[model samples]
Target: MVTPSTQEKARLGGRADVGAASVAGAEYSTIEHALSDALAAHGITGLAIRADGGIHRFDSADKPKGNRNGWYVCPTLEVAVYGFWHTGEQHTITTGGKADPAAAAETRLAYQRAREQREAERRAQQARTAEQARRWWAAAGAADPNHPYLTKKRLAPYGLRQRDTMLLVPLFHDGELVNLERIYPHGAKKALFGGRAKGVASLVGSLASADRVLVAEGWATAAALHEAMGVPVVVARNADNLEPVARRLRQRLPDDVTITIAADDDRFTEGNPGATKARLAALAIGAKVLMPTFCPGCARCTDFADVALCRKERVA
Candidate 1:
């Protein structure tokens, strides 16, 4: 009988003994397989590994469908790096091979490059979007008083402009017009795609020569508060932005200027995020928290705007 070497015997037995360990049902037969399994573990699946030491991106499971926020790169056959842009999450993996510090270093450099590239792209997109916003704002006409949205909300235009059928509420960042929140007739609202919205806000009344400024979540809420109390109001747009907007307003005004955070009491939603975030924002700036005081047995009212409209309807 012919004696077979250890390698030949393994081949003859239909198995390759490359000393790769298995984990979580992932076959570590090769670097490509190992990387694919690691990605699947993070809920990112159905991706074809290039294995050519190049960066690749795919849709992240946590984000909406078709959003390619997840990225991975294999700097060498042994080492790979991966991350999600939306959440700033990152991970590293290596094949069942000898530890190579040089390969690990290459992976780290690749991740840094990926992050820099993303930031550059984001800045470019924001710049283009801002230019478009300015053009649209300049061309829009004053909002008609009888528009369905304004009538339904029982609010005056308050200097809001109208483009076609959409009501345009100008958004400012550092006193520059950077975006517009378009409100449709059916009450839907959206900002321009790729426009910067964080820390941006709208003004309901003039802050000049004013000692008290109120920050509220929505434009209608700001309008209602301004009309009721005759105080300048800043519209933060949403619950998540309450803190950033409040902090900026506090810094811009004089020390004696009092800021009241008018919270939307989202009593129906679990945890009432609006009221919670509003209190946090007020605490941050030492501002007073003002929550909506609903009338007796009123369950549908949530914010200042809702209360104002409800009272108007009762009078009508």
Candidate 2:
């Protein structure tokens, strides 16, 4: 009796084991089989290829997560099964079908043209969005103290405006309004789609005469912290923008000015993005970090504002 090694089986592209069963260690003979096995191992069962070089997760396709495939790979339009699932790691094996050089050249040219067109369209759209944001800023009145989100958060609107039941928060980049985030009565929040989102922030207080400043995520948190700490809090809006906003602030602010990253303590979520990003932003600038102090036996609170409000309620 003869037995094939795992690497040998992979090279042969012949399935040593096939089924819905555990073939994680088992090797496959063909590129299709190996690719299929890789995806199946990651829980992508159906593997439906869509019309736009996209691989669906199951028999019926839904919106791809991360706004990108992020899961499967497609080397060519004709040879999709040649691709393998990348696990955000350095892929070692290179068994996928080779794309035709000439065909790839044409695709590159087409992609360039499409990218340019999209860029032009995006610029135009941003201009339109900026104009709309300016108009809304002018037309809307000051945010009401009785607004649902404001009341629930127990924070007054710094410079926000009311549009019907939604509170409009203007987001700026380089002193120019680029986008707006609307807070609904139900606490749902959304930024204007297609508008520039990165590195933009909504200010809660004046930066004038400020030697040390606090930076945080979310408008309510920043507002609450500014009230409690008596320092200007720059709302970085989200975790991903922390680094960019911090770098920009470092460049723009004075050498003597201190920037403290008041990161949200995202204890519920995996990876603790809020605190991790805060530390990264502070580390990049050689600044300080002010984490939220959750009270003893606190279970749900994950931010400075939440903790502050809890303390206030307890006092009352």
Candidate 3:
């Protein structure tokens, strides 16, 4: 019996000991001719025939398996049909199954359009935030030439140069700077508990005269509340820091003072550390926890300032 070498066995779809070239050759020729005719009718190009009775339009690195060794097809244009060869028989595996070129083009266009829209929105948001920050500084007396927080040149002093710098979000009462709380960016090395304003008995002392006081988590939220309620506001640098501020308020203010902890709905959701802090603070002080409805696209209504603005927009 004639034995086939490794190369010859691969050519005949057999083990090294088997000589199946004669059977393969007889069956493959008829199938190959029919497949070529079909490919021509479909306007496919770059056609190449393989020794193992397969046809392919593209170069593939993967080794063909089983009966597929002699059958391969790829579309040269947007779509292409595939044909299978079974011994002397020819079978069209797929026809009129080409991918839509227009659809692929539309996908790319849609991605580009989305990217542009996001970029535009980001720029607009930054502009609006910067304007809001400017207005806040002006309202808090930081923009005044004689203000202690302002430099001799009339600019606000840039604080701590280190990575973990504290930002003071000031709460104003009747145009007077009454309370200030320190805050650091998220994931900073510093602790979440912030320092209170100098010479102030408590953060709540600023709102003593007001019938209702709004408490919030951040400076932005405090600003939002001030805009919304037109009442006195106090900002907690972070949610966890609310307890000390609340404790101070209880000691300084009259027993009848109505303090509202502006809670964010996000706290009720599981695994929100900030919300957890707010809840604990409210419970300790016996303060009313007011959770405002969040805006549709807003991340969370954690801060009074954010809630105030978001709520107004929703109502409008």
TM-score of each: 0.86, 0.71, 0.36
Candidate 2, 179-202: lDDT as tens digits: 899999988988886788789988
The TM-score-based order of candidates, best leading, equals 1, 2, 3
> Which candidate leads the pack in lDDT?
1
Give candidate 3 regions above 4 Å deviation: 1-141, 144-208, 267-270, 295-304, 307-316
Clashing pairs in 3: 54-70, 221-305, 224-305, 225-305
Report the candidate with higher TM-score, 1 versus 2. 1
Instruction: RMSD for all candidates, in order, please.
Output: 8.9, 8.0, 22.7
Instruction: Estimate, for each residue in 191-308, the C-alpha lDDT of model 3 and write its tens digit.
Output: 2122222222213224647777766665455555565566766655566667766666666678877877776555546877666666787888888777666556666655444555
Angstrom error at residue 4, model 1 = 36
The CA lDDT of each predicted structure is 0.81, 0.67, 0.43
Model 3 is weakest, by summed lDDT over 10 consecutive residues, at: 1-10
lDDT of 1 by residue, 1-316 (tens): 1111111112211221122224743435566777687677778777888878767789988888878898888777766667787776665566653334565465557677777777787899889999999999999999999999999989999969999999999999999998889999999999998898899999999999998999999999999999999999999999999999999988988999999999999999999999999999999999899998999999899999999999999999
Cα RMSD for predicted model 3: 22.7
TM-score of 2: 0.71
Q: On lDDT, who's better, 1 or 3?
A: 1
The superposed Cα distance between candidate 3 and the true structure at residue 32, in angstroms, equals 82
